[model samples]
Each structure stands twice: as C-alpha cells, then as structure tokens.
Target: LAKTTQPISMDSYEGQEVNITCSHNNIATNDYITWYQQFPSQGPRFIIQGYKTKVTNEVASLFIPADRKSSTLSLPRVSLSDTAVYYCLVGVLSGGAQKLVFGQGTRLTINP
Candidate 1:
C-alpha cells in the first residue's frame, strides 16, 4: 500500500495537547500504523505503533479506529523542545522483517 498523505505543518504553544491525523485510505489488513518523531540533525525515533485500537507509550499515543484506514498521533503537554517533524509510517511486519514506507510528514512547531 502507498504511504498516507502528508498533513500541513502545525503550530502549538507549550503545555498544549497536539493531535496529528494521518490518512491511509487504501491501507491493507496486514498493515500496521507507526508514528515517528525527528529532530534536526537526528534520525527518526519511533513514537508508537498499533494495528488497531490504541497504543500508548511514554512519548506519544497512537489511535486507530476499527477500519484501520486512518490513525492519529497524540502528544500530551508538549513543550518547546517537542518542536520537530512527525511521521506516520505504514507497513507490514512478518517474521522479524518489516518494510515501512513514509511520505512527507507533518512539521510540528511548539512555541513558547
């Protein structure tokens, strides 16, 4: 399946909750939704992953509805340091191997 659409850049003040939505209309049943965060001069770091329902981690939470065609990445109480690019990846993992494709991600800028 193709990667989801790239959302527009978002701006938020510190101490706010941010939710970025990703659309994968043709997502396959085997596909899993994964979110990543990237900072300047650094590689993308995994934020959360889910096949359906919801998945939460220390950094972020991923929400996938029953259809699994779209997902949202939720960040709570973001700070200025949270300003970065966020990506939503779709892929199928099998037998310890994964093939994930990414499109242009959303740029989230947290202001003071």
Candidate 2:
C-alpha cells in the first residue's frame, strides 16, 4: 500500500483558492492519486483523481507532476462551506479504488 503525507492543517477565507499538496514518494506507477473532502461526521466525498498531468471536475482539480511522486489538489474560489478535511489517497484501480485505507488527513478551515 502507498502512504501519503500532507500538512496537518490549513486556513483560508471566503473566495480563496486553496491548494493542498500531498507527498507519496513510494507510490507505484499503476497507482492513482485521489482526493476526497469530508465534512464533520460524514463520509468523504470524492473530489478528483489523476494519474499524471492534471484532472479537473466541477468541484476541484488534481495536478500530478511527471515524476508522480507528489500531487496537488486545487480548490478554486472556496467558500466557508468548503471547510472540511481533505484526504490524499493512493491506490490501484484494479485493487478496489473505493476501498481506500484510512489515514490522517489535512484539516481545512475556512473563515469569513
């Protein structure tokens, strides 16, 4: 299994673009980077996924460098409601991508 490391916490304000980076130096070539956002007492919601380069969706964008040793999750113009814990997961699609192992995540706090 691949392990990920990210900042313990972050702070932002309304209408701010927040970027969270995660390091996975041991990630395998077949592994993919997945970002999830979880609100209090709720299940994590998938934000985006990427193997290399960039991937964008309605909520966020995932950027993976060519080396694939790290990835950055970009949240564009976030609001106070965007406050939540973000997780960077590394897993292989064939190995059940949805079955991500639990780990410490980055807590994002949005203020007015």
- Candidate 1 structure lDDT: 0.85
lDDT by residue (28-67, candidate 2, tens digit) is 6676788888999999998898999999988998899999
lDDT of each: 0.85, 0.84
Candidate 1 on 1-112: residue-level lDDT in tens? Answer: 4557768699999999999999877665687888888999999998888999988988888889998878999999999989999998886444456566675799999999
Considering summed lDDT, which 10 consecutive residues are worst modelled in model 1?
91-100
TM-score of 1: 0.87
CA RMSD, predictions in order: 3.6, 3.4
Q: Which 10-residue span in candidate 2 carries the lowest summed lDDT? A: 92-101
- Give the number of the best model, judged by lDDT: 1
